[model samples]
Target: MRPGATRVGIIDYGMGNLYSVAKAVEHLGASAVVSDRAEVLAGTDRIIFPGVGAFGDCMAALEARELTDFVRVAAQTRPFLGICLGMQLLMESSEEHGAHAGLGLLPGRVLAFPPGAMRDRDGRPLKVPHMGWNELHQLVAHPLFAGIPQDAHFYFVHSFYVEPANPELLAAFADYGFPFCAAVAVDNLFALQCHPEKSGEAGLRLLGNFLAWDGGGGPACGI
Candidate 1:
């Protein structure tokens, strides 16, 4: 590894999109280390928490690995990025399988989209998962979307969405049946409901921006 190269720790509690997220970081010229050990992760410059499973299950895995508190602390000190279910875990609680508590890093609740409330452009009932590509409506100007265009299409596959207590945390929204939180940014923490690793160029750009971010709440530099 090059001297002083960004070391991104992709948190692996057996539920995240580990390899793909690591590869994405490596592709952006940063060192990617996917591990569950707090000591190993603590050595890195940034953290990427990516998940692809149920809220309760993922939280259990994190607890099993004794990483729940580790993550909560890490987010405060590093440039933290959470993706998909990883994003939901940062909230106060989730209603996925029942009332399950979250990391409470962000003040909010993860809620399931009401069934039969969403309709396609053609007026057909949309699926619950809300899969495939969708347009992101940028609600706030942040470094995470520095190069991405407004209303850019990104990949999404989720039934639950986060509702933050503080509206200022909202970075972007995407319409499924109605507008929903697609991304949130606060201080050093930035998270996304969409899989930027799977969203192609725009996603890659976003990841690159994250790799270069200094957690200063300003535009990413040295990209």
Candidate 2:
């Protein structure tokens, strides 16, 4: 991390590919530090939560780290970003395995894909895990999509979608079985269901926009 560059704290709560996410942040000219310590967290300008696997496992890991409170603070006090399962965990709860509680940063629940509703072009049952490039239809405007073109295709890999109680928070949506929340934002907090690290240039640009965000949320906190 070079001096004066924006430092992004990539929370390492025992999930997801932190390395690749770090690389993507660095590629956007920001420093990505993976840490769970409250002390290290105070040193960054923004934070990112990237995770994979089950929601129950993620909640357990967060509880073990004793960093849950700090994460909630970061989400409200700074520009926060969540990716994939990380995004799902930002909601109030998830139905992945029985019932699992999330960070409650957003007013919604993560739900499994409606079984019979998931179908292919010819009406065959689509696979459980939706994997591949899908187009995101923009429903709201935000700094996260600053330079990214509308209706851009992003790589997605998930079987769950967020049902936000406040529909105004949804930034984009993609249709599989039905339209599902693909990205969400409320003030400074943001989450993306697509892997910006794998969506090629368009994804990279979204990261770059995040790196360059200079809203009134907070001052540049050093890298």
Among these predicted structures, which one has the highest TM-score? 1
TM-score (C-alpha, index-matched) for candidate 2: 0.93
The lDDT of each candidate is 0.90, 0.85
The residue pairs found clashing in candidate 1 are none
Cα lDDT of model 1 by residue, 1-223, tens digit: 5667799999999988898898888888899999999999999999999999999999999999999988999888889999999999999999999999999988899999987678867888988898999999998778888899998889998889999887878889999988999998888889999999999999999999998888976433211
lDDT of 2: 0.85
Structural similarity to truth (TM-score) of each candidate? 0.95, 0.93
lDDT of 2 at 143: 76
Q: What is the C-alpha RMSD of each candidate to the true structure, in Å?
A: 3.3, 3.9
Q: Point out where model 1 deviates above 4 Å.
A: 1-3, 218-223
